[model samples]
Target: MKLGFIGTGKITAAVVQGLCTSGIDGLSIAVSPRNEATSSFLAQHFSNVRRMHSNQQVLDHADIVCIAVRPDQAAHVLSQLRFREDHIVVSFVSFLTCHELVRAVAPARQSCRAIPLPSVIHHTCPIPVFPAIGPVMDLFSTIGQPVTVDNETQLHALWTLTGLISPFYDLLGSLSDWTVSHGVRPDTASQFTADLFQSLAHAARQSDPIAFDALAHHAATPNGMNEQAAHEILASGAHQAYRQACDRLVQRFPILDE
Candidate 1:
């Protein structure tokens, strides 16, 4: 399998790192030289990966080309590149629908839209893909749980959820700070706070039906501390605020009228 990436940003770097360490045979990668530091780092660390002088060079180097450029640069960047009919392009640019991307990468009959988290470096994360392109799906499955959606609306909803990464970290940071204020060591506080959430998530994943309310109810016994915390968080409308924030973010990806 051969892969090339047009942009060497964080997500691209993560994907490259994961794929290189994934132990897949006959795999080679080429990355554009736009982000010299990242491209250099990958080339230096991975034997199968190399840096290309231009986006066109990257495209020519691999059968599958991934676009990781910023949303603002997507149109301009792709407009300048030439694609082959056999090429399969996967785009990481937000708000660029598969249709728009297909037009941008014309001559390329196969295209996919995807956004993977940095956790992919560990070969474990949710990778949301659209249209269920088989090769793209198979490739992502090697590194993460590839969840394919039938419609763009659901894809947009999933992308909106990605915005919560920072807020989720803040929640953990706040809890760690609270413990530090009580005289706990900073390292111990951070580790305990992170482990608490990770364990909770793992437990929730084990639930057969995976009902959040059911899990919350189980954790929050009659007038227990867990119940107190849940009550305060929900009663303050923090949960609803997350929904509203998602609503706002989803608006950023308007339905592209055909």
Candidate 2:
């Protein structure tokens, strides 16, 4: 299979790295040269990876094309490229619905929208895709669990929750800084904070029919620290704030419109 990447940003870099390291033989990868450092690095490090001179060149060389351009640049950049009717286009552009992408890449009959987090490099994340396509889902499965959604609205909701990732890290950082303020070593504090969340997430993932409320009840003993903290956060409107933030983020996607 031949694959082409239009933007060599961090997500593209991570996906390329994962694909190269994945044990998928007889696969050729082509990357646009816009992000020279990343494109050059992937080309130099991977045997089957090639750095192409232009976006058009990348499209010309591959059977499947993955668009990873930023939202602002997606329309303008894609307008210049010519895609064949036989080529498959999988987009990672946030806020750009599949309808918009189809218009942008006309003649390309197969178009898919995918959301792949940075952890995809570790082959550990849920890759959500809209309007399920066999080849796109199969390709994403190599890097993460591919979840094919029936509608764009459901897919956009998953994409909206992804916006909370940064906030999650910031919350962890704040907890780590609290420990530091209480005299814990900086490195130790950071490591503990990260591991605490990682183990919690792992546990949640392993549980069958997992429920947030069930986990909360299991963790919070009577008058225990966990219960106290949960009460404090919830009573302080932190949980409500999180919901509001997610709702706002979802509004940015036009597909979610009523």
Candidate 3:
């Protein structure tokens, strides 16, 4: 497949990295000129990747065009490009509806919205949603697990879930900092927190039919250290604060109508 990326940002770089590392055959990537450093880096490290002179060149030369621009810049970028009827256009920009994509690339037949994280580079599980279209399903599945959604609302929900990752990381960082302040070495604190999460993730994956809440309850036994910490967090409303943050993200999702 001849693939082109319209905005060469972090996500685009991650996707290109994933594709290059996956050893998938017959793949050629052309990246936009917006992030010159990333585009040049990919071209230098990957044999099949090239840097296009302009975004239009990406649309003109590639069979599958990916729009990776920020939501605010999407309309302006689309307004300046052209696409053929048979071209497949996939967007990583959240909340832009398929209809909006169709209108952007006027004559395109296939349009899809996909969400991919940096984890995709390792072929680890990635949250991918395509409202419609089969090719995107097949393509992303090669890089990670892919889920198909039937409507735009579900796609928006998926996007909100993606937005949760950053704050989750911040929460972990706070926990790590707390440990460091308590005299744990900084490196040891960070490593311990990372390993703890890794172990928890692995446990969740391995424990079939075991409910997560049940696992947490078991870990937080009556009068135990875990239970005491949990109580303090709940009493301080930290959990509620996280929930409100998530709610705000849902409210701020960048729909095409905006």
Measured on C-alpha atoms, candidate 2 has an lDDT of 0.92
Q: What is the TM-score of each candidate against the true structure?
A: 0.98, 0.96, 0.91
Q: Where is model 2 poorest over a 10-residue stretch in terms of lDDT?
A: 249-258
Give the range where candidate 3 is weakest over 10 consecutive residues by summed lDDT. 249-258
lDDT string, candidate 3, 1-258, tens digits: 899999999998988998888877899999999899989999999999989899989988899899999999999999999889989999998757778877998888888888988888777756566665677777787778888776676777677777778887987899999999999999999999999998998898788786888788889989999999988989999888877867888877655442
Which portions of model 3 miss their true places by more than 4 Å?
Answer: 254-258
TM-score-superior candidate, 2 or 3? 2
Question: Least lDDT summed over 10 consecutive residues: which range in candidate 1?
Answer: 249-258
How much lDDT does candidate 3 score? 0.85
- Please give the RMSD to the true structure for each candidate, in Å: 1.0, 1.4, 2.3
Residue 61 of model 2: what lDDT? 97
lDDT of 1: 0.93
* Model 2: lDDT of residue 2: 98
lDDT (C-alpha, whole model) for all candidates:
0.93, 0.92, 0.85
